[model samples]
Structure formats: C-alpha cells, structure tokens
Target: MADIISLGIDTGGTYTDAVIFSDARGVIAKAKSLTTRHDLSEGIAGAADAALAAAQIDSREIRLVSLSTTLATNALVEGQGQRVALVMIGFGEDDLARDGLGEAARAGPVIFLPGGHDVHGRETPLEMERLQVALPQLAQEVSAFAVAGYFAVRNPAHEQRVRDLILRDAGLPVTCSHELSSRLGGPRRALTTLLNARLVGMIGRLVGACEAYLSSRNIAAPLMVVRGDGALISASEARLRPIETILSGPAASLAGAQFLTGLDNAVVSDIGGTTTDVAILENGRPKLDPDGAMVGGHRTMVEAVAMRTFGLGGDSEVRVDLAGLIARIELGPRRVLPLSLIGHRFSDIVIPALEKQVGSVHAQRNEGLFAIRTGLPDSMAAGLSAQEASLYARITDQPQPLTQLLTTAPQKSALDRLAARGLAHISGITPSDALHVLGRQGQWNAAAARLGLDLAARQKGGNGKPIAADAEDLANRIVQRLTRQSSHAILEACLTDDGETGIDPAKSRAIARALDRQPGVVRFSLALDRPLIGLGASAPVYYPAIAEELAAPAVIPDHADVANAIGAVAGQIRETVTVFVTSPEEGIFLLNGSGETLRFVSETEALEAARARAIEHARALAARNGLAEPHIELMEDADAAEIEGKRKLVEARVRAVASGRPRVAN
Candidate 1:
C-alpha cells in the first residue's frame, strides 16, 4: 500500500489540478490547467497528462485514482444545475416555505403527495395516482426527481416505493431524502434531496467523463471521490449523492493542510478562484457541523465539515461603491471571469476592446466589462425564454463589450439569466487582474490587466475625482481590500467555531480598528489562539498579509497549490451508520433507523440489536466503497429521564463507523 502510486485530481472554479502521489515519497509531481466551463474532461486530461509526464510514471503504475470537485458547490451557489422535479410525499406546500426550500425549489416544479410514515415507523396509506399521471410528463421536463416522505428515516418504505416507481416508469434518476440522511427533519431533508436530484446528472456526467478518460489512457484503477467530511467514497456512490460533496474541495484541502504541515491545531483557510473556505482543526481533525452543511444559503441535512465558505476569492467581482464620500472598493458574492485570463486566451479580441475602452477620454459605464459565450452545447440551451434566447444568440465566441451587448435594463437582466444557466460568462476586473497589474502574478495577460484597470480608474467618484491617480494605485487598493476581507473571514470562522458571542468580525468597529492597527485612545488588539494554515495556489502570494493582520504565524506548505489533489489521494474510505432504540410505550422498545425497523419487548435486547445492525450496515457500506480490512468502532448515546422516582429510557442512538484504506490492485 505504501509503494502503490495514486493519481489525484481536483476540479475547481478556475483550475483543475492533478497530482501523482506515493505514500513513501509524498508528492511526486503536480500540474494545473485552466478549468473549462463548457467541457470538464479537457481540463482533467490536460492536468493529468502533464503531471504523469512530469513524474515519468506509466499509466499502469497507478493503483488508485481519486477526485475532489467544486462543481456541485458552485452550481448550488450560483443557481446552476439540471432541472429536477421535487416529489414531496406526505409533505404540504407550507413545508417548502421553511429552510429556504421554496427559493431553492424554483429550479423546477414541486409535486406533493399524501403518503408518509409515523415516528414509530408506521406507514400512512400512500396515494400515487396523481404521481402516476404526472410521471411521464415530468420525465420529459426534468432531468431527475427528488422524493421526501415525512418520517421516512424511521422507515423508508414510502421513499423506496416512490423511488422504484420512478425508476421503473420515468426511467430517470431519483434521490430519496431517507437515502441522503436518517435525520427526522422533513423539509430540510427534502431540501437536501432536492439539491441532490438537481446535481445528479451534472456529477454523473463528470464521473463518467473521468472514467472514460482513464480507460482511454489504460489507467486501471479504482476511482474514489472526496466527501464533504474529508473522507473517501467510491465514485459510483458520489454520483448518486453529490450534495454530500458540496465542500469536497475544501474538505480535501483540510486533509492536505494537516498532512503538509503536521499541525494538530490550526485555522485552515483554503482560497480558490470562486470562494475562500475557512475552518479550524483540533487534534488534527476538522469538526463536523452538527446542524448539517449549509450551502447556497440553504441549510441541508447532508453531513459535512463545519466550514464557513465566503464568496471572497481571486476571481471575485470587483466593483466601486460611490454611495459614500470616498468611493469604496468591494469584492464579491458573485464570481466573474477575470479580465487577465480572458485576455490571455482571447487576446486578439480582448486586447483591442480593452485598448479602445482605455483610449476613451470620458469614463463610461461598463468600460472594463465584457461578456462571452461559454460554448455549451445547444441541448443545455433548451427551454430558454424569448428574451434569454435573443440575448444569447447575440453573444459570440469573441468577447463583446457589455455596453454594446446590453442596451437596456431588460437586456442586462437577460444576460444575467444566461450566465446563471451556464451558457454565458461575464468577464471583469478581479483580484487576479490586480495581481497581474502589480507584477505579483504573471500567469495571465498583464497588459490587458493594466488596460482594464486604467478604464476602471477613470470612473468619477462621489468626491468628483477620478477613483485613483493611475491603474497601479487602483490595483494596490484592490489587493489590500482582498487581504483585509480574507483576514476578517478567517477571524469570523474562528470566533463562531469557538462559540463566542456578540462580536461579528464584519460589523465590529473594535475588531476593524484592531485589524487595521489604527491609533486610538482606546486601543484594541486581536490575534488567533492558533497559527493560520493557508492552502491554495495563491496562498503563498496572499496569505502572509492575512496572517500578519491577525498576528498569527503563516504556514504555507510546499505544493500547497495542489493540496486538494494530494488530499484526495491521501484520504481513506470511511462509512458511518446510526440506529435508534426508542421506547414509544411502557414495557416495549422500538428499534429503527438507517432504513430498518424492528420491535423488541426487552430494552437490553433492543439496544444490542441496534448496535449489531449499525455495525452490519456500516461494514456493508465500507465494503461496497472498496474499503479493505475495514475496522469498526461503535459509539453509544443513551438518553434517559427521571420519571416518578425511577429512571426511564427515552432513547438510545447506536452509531457504527467503518474505516480503512481503499483496496489495492489485485
């Protein structure tokens, strides 16, 4: 196992990283390529080929291949995914109003049915006539379906029946809420299943493409995917429940940071093109969010790392705020194509447009902005409204100035809709462009970056002056803003995780003064209790300043840029199952959970049965996930209350965890 080679890949918002790894020698070689929005396989193959060539390793030498991806997270955040119909069994329309489920449910139509289970695993008479009539029409309209039944976790009979019916009649992928989690929250579980359904086709396509690429190269290896908890699962399992991988890339980076720095306690901040994820490590392990992973503003029931994902990163959209006397520089909750990289790839079109914009005397609206087609296939463009279709048809391969492309407010909105659907992209100045202008990062088109900055600097401020004296000054301001925001994000995550109260990092004036190191009569200072471990391609360039502001030491490990890929390869397979032993009545114990139900007269017998059942299910899952020589650990959480001078058992949760490395090539 130590000698076997592992191939690791991570698909991120800006780049796809690939690495060749050996447990004995550590990271052997790593490569990064621009992530292609239109087609992901091209980027994956490019990085893999480069890494393999650098390592001088043949495809046959690799025994394992693992991947981490941000596509699912990005889709949920940006409202991009395949259309999926939600079939809510035993849930009402009012259920959608909770947990931001209604807003998230707008991806497709939601259908309600009358069939559910009681907390004790009792079934409600299921009525499927409405579903039967609608399945065929839904199959044509949606790419997948999500079904959630009340109390389905206690007994998944209703969910299973609906799943079987959909698979048989509609022939479409169906995600059942009980299959995603055993928790009892119907609406939140439905939200998770709804999201999982939407991501199924997208993730399945990505996994299929990777498998095909590996097969073509004769890389015969078991493929695995990094889960949001930083554990590994078979690729097939990942494709079925990709919502669990919402924080996959960030979770992998946590493992990579721990492995690279050997740190037991540190704050891990992994910055990527689209977002900066912040989390803390204690005892060399990241904590799981008990409330479940919250992505795209929806609190889901999928178990994941307690990571605070802030929409502040390299390619974050840069805009100027003129509401105040001093125009403020702001970064994003929205990501756009960086001007530098777009110019690097399409210089002929980008450079001339930018040049013309910079050559103008007066500062104009959207002078530094451009829109380009992502080149997605026409099938993805299906069901586009007339306004969106018209706007999209006008967008070509060549980057067009936003001022020219969007003449009216409605057209501007239409372009936004098109971008949201992944059919188009908007390019503008970003921190990456700022880096290029400052000569700190030279991977892209620096001249175009300068031109874009110059055009932006020409904007008249609220003070009736140019925003900056020159492009270089404006670039400095942008970088400083990013550093300030990054430090705040890290501090916020630390404070929240440490269970502190009242002091919000973003809004606290005292905290701001401390970070800014301002001179004041009432002086304040802040520092982290632990060092900051920064992991990402840009960590070396940006994290030192962030660490300095927080008064913490910076640990930027070697190959930090490819840490996500390294984490994917270094992770082990792990599966967990939980069973419940509840006393619904006196003198009787009812056992249920994880899709199983049983009855017992004695509490001792029922508790023991729950333990064995959990262990059995956990091991079965581990085996199915390719874990060899698996080790099982059990945890007992018993609940009791004093009642009438006697201690009565209320409930007991038996949890079993199975873990081991993936099986090597036979």
Candidate 2:
C-alpha cells in the first residue's frame, strides 16, 4: 500500500511553515520561509515546495492538506484589516456603547437603520430607504459591510434582508450577526459580525492563495483549516467566518505541543513573530475558554482554546521610556519588521541609511525606521484621505527611510495611518535585530542591527545621559527587557488560569518580588505547578529563561518550531450545531437554530424538532469537513422554574457535536 501523506501548512506573521506527515512515520520533512506579505502565496508556495523537495515525495502522494494561520490574530493585535462599514438595524447610538462596538469600529463608518425583530422573531418594519441611500457611498469607502439586526439570533429576517441588499448593490462581502453566532446580545453579536466582515477579504485571500497554489501543483487533496478550538473545519467554512480562526495558529500550537511532548498537564507557550500565546493543557487536552476568545482586548464570541495571547514576540517593536529616573525598554503590542530582516533584503538602502543616521551630530527621531509598500494591490487603497494617499504614493517597493519619507509631523501621522491600513510596512529596531546584534541569531545583517542599536543607544535617558554605552549594550538591554516582559506575560496567563483575577501580575508586589527574587523580611516565592512546554522557532532561545523565572521546568520538543504545522494535520474533523427553544408564553414554543426559526404548539414537538435539526446540521457540517461516520454527542440545557406548584419551561438549548478523523484520499 502507498503511504498516505498529509501536508500541513501554517502561515505566521513572520514565517510560513510547511510539514509533511504520515500516520505511520510522523513528520517526514518540514521547511520554513519568510512570509511574503505582498502576496502570501509566495510564502506558501515557497514553504510547500521546499517541504516536498526535502521529503522527496511526489505531490500526488499527499492525501490531505490542512492549514492554520495567525493572520486574523495578528491583524487584531496590530489593528490592521480591510476597512468595513457596519449597518445596525434597530440599534441606537447607545447600543454601540454596550459592547465596545464603537471602539472596535475604529473610525469606520456605521449606519443605524430603524428596523429589527422582537424577542419572538417578529419583524418590526425594517427601513430599507436609509440602507439604500448609504450603501453605494459606503461601498466606495469600505471593502466590506456588516449587517446586524436587533435580536438577529432570534429572527434573522431583517439582517438577511440587509445582507442581500448589500450584496446586490455593493457586491462586497457581507457578514450578518446570525451567521457568526447564536448568542442573544445584539451589540456584542454585531461587534463579532463587524470584525468578521473586516476579516473576510483578508482570510479569503489567504485561503484562496493556498487553494490556487495547491491546484497549480496538482496536489489533489482535501483541504481543511484549523479552527480556534483546535478542530478541523472545511476551508470554505473558515473563509466565510474567519473570526472563528482568530486563534487558529495558537490552537494548532497547543495541539502540537501535546502531540510532540506527550505531556498531559503543562503550560504550553508558543512564541511567534507577532504574539506569544499561552494555554494550559490538562488531562491531555487543551481547555476551552467559556467566555470566548479575547484578542487585542476585545472578547469575541468565538469558541477557542483558553489561550492568553500577548503582543510580545521576536519581531515586537522595541520602545524606550525615558520618563523615569532610569530609562526603561518596552517591547510591543505592535510588530515591526526587524532591522536585520529589512537590512538583509535591502542592505544597500538600509545599511547606508543606518550608517548616516548613527554618524549624525544629533539623535534623529526616526533614525532607525523605514517604510516600504506592502505590495498589496492599489484597490485596497480605497477611501484613503488626501494626506494618506499622498504619503502612500511616495512609498514604493524599495525601502525608504522614514526620516526621508516624512518631512513634517502631518506626513508622519499620514504614514502611520497608511501602515495601520496594511498598505505599508514600517521596519525598525526589534528583538529580532537585538538577537542579530548579540550574535545569537545570524540569519540577517548584523552590521545594520548594530547601527540601529547605536542610534537607539544615543537617545537621552531620564537621568540626562545616554541609555547605553554602546550598540551591544543597548541590544542586550532590549533583549533582557523582552525576557522580562515574556515572563510577566506567562505569569499573567497563569494567574488568570488559576482564577486569581484580583492580583494583576504587572502590579502585584508579591509576584514582582517573586520574579525579581528580592530578599526581604517577608520573602515572597511563586512557581507554576506544572511544567512549561515551549513551542516556536525562537522558543529554545527565549523560553528557558522564562521557565526559570516562573520556577517551572522547560520542555522544548524536537520539532517545536514546526509545531503549528504538525498540529494542523494532526487535528480531527469536528462540527457543532446549536438549537434554542424559547417560550414567549404558555403553549407556544419557538425554536431557533441553523439560521431558521420554527413555531410549534407543543413543547415536546418543539424539542424534538430542534434535536433533529441540530443532529442533521451537525452531520452535514461533519461531512463537509471531510468526516464520514463521525461520533455524535448530544447535550441539552433547559432553563425552568417552579412557580405556584407548576413546572414552567423558560428556554432550552440543544447542541449536537460530531467529530472524527478526516477521511484520507484514495
């Protein structure tokens, strides 16, 4: 019999990884490539081709293809995505304030229309005139539209109507609240839908790129995407609801950590280019977050691993704080291209620019910064302000020093706006550069890293002195600061997992003293109960120190760097369907689920219908996910109260879950 090989691909912020795996032999080969943001397909193809070549296997031997990515997570963390307009039905301005929707909108246009549905899925006269007038102009201003109606979970009629209109008129990707989640909170659901809408174009491109590449290779295999919950779903499903993939990469890492280390109880921390994700594995499986996946401070209703994502990573922008007695270095919540990387790619431009800046008489504000076009098509530049457009036009494929690119303060702001919109990339001093300067990493130009650090070292501190004596000293300081921040991030995740909400790791004196190993009359000591399993290409370099600080044993598996890719192929196909039965009054039960609402006169009839529908939906979804005979599990939660010696049925939720191994191609 021929070996049944599976291809797993993971696209992270900095690198794209690919691994070839077989059930009998484990990982046969793995390869990595720098992620090409201009066109992700370049990175995907590079990694895939390298892996296939390394394995010396025919592409036709691959039976399954699974993918995972951190693009959605990184986009949220960095506040970068396609601009989208939100259409709210039957929601007032006050509703926007309820779920951080206004803040999440982030200067995006929002239109409130007078239409909605009641608790029982009854229409409240949807107003089409406002949407008709606003959509055309909004389409020019945004890449997609989100339509969320009040109580859309109960009745999606209004939201569906608006979605159809947007699709017909704007011909843009549309996300309706009901399509994403079955939750009841209108504002929160709207927020999820809006975020999903923002990600549709981005995620669609990613999946489309992978599919196109696969088709070109003639590697006929079923494609699956890892979900935020560490399960496999059809690529088509993921393209429509990308919000569910917010933690897809992290979740895959969690699965890979377990599969590689075989540790039942451990704290799994995966560091990537853009984020450090931490989660606890218990009973040989990752725990699910009941409150939903929270990324970049927004709690989404996407079911995912109980992972805490931090913005500290190798490519994190390094900033200095000179406001105190001693200057302190801080790593990022934003990722910047490492000077080493940009220097390697554009050495002529980068080295000369850095050398000039370091030799200057005075320290320049933008000495070590450069901006380059991200290589996305100009169509994404829609709705750019005049200043933003002008600055963007000046940026080209070649790297331009930010000092030369921005002549004035307004132009600097405009450049920033362009970067935020993903039209441009800013390269600066980062932990990766620090690694290069320290000689720990040698993949890029170390001279450029030294030059960038020299510029950073010249900055005045709070004590009115240079922060460091030399470039190496400053690079060490930056690396040490990253280590400290990473420790704090791990500690914070541990505290949150232990349900110690009152003690903030950043401010907790006890934790600080413990981490600092400060000796006093009252000595404080803390340690994690479980060992730490570190996964990432850079994990071996950074996690040992972090584990020591936490007083936990560190475990870095052999293939830790390619863990996400391994997990992508090792996951199982799983699908879930939920049905809700609500009683508006006695003797009338309304069932809601699977994007439809049905009324039944009797409670038994309503429950039976809901159960049957949920099972059917789950089975269908499982089949779509490439599962044949999935094991099905049914769970029901019914809320009832006893009043005046009578049993009252308030509501009931029925859920069906189907899961199995993905089918292999013949």
What are the per-residue Cα lDDT tens digits for candidate 1 across 29-51?
99999998767788999999999
Candidate 2's error at 529, in angstroms? 0.5
TM-score of 1: 0.95
TM-score of candidate 2 relative to the true fold: 0.98
Clashes of each: 0, 0
Question: Each model's TM-score?
Answer: 0.95, 0.98
What 10-residue stretch in candidate 1 is worst by lDDT? Answer: 375-384
lDDT of each: 0.88, 0.90
Candidate 2 clash total? 0
lDDT of 2: 0.90
After superposing candidate 2 on the true structure, give the runs of residues whose Cα lies further than 4 Å from its correct spot: 1-3
Q: Following a full C-alpha superposition, what root-mean-square deviation does model 2 have from the true structure?
A: 1.3
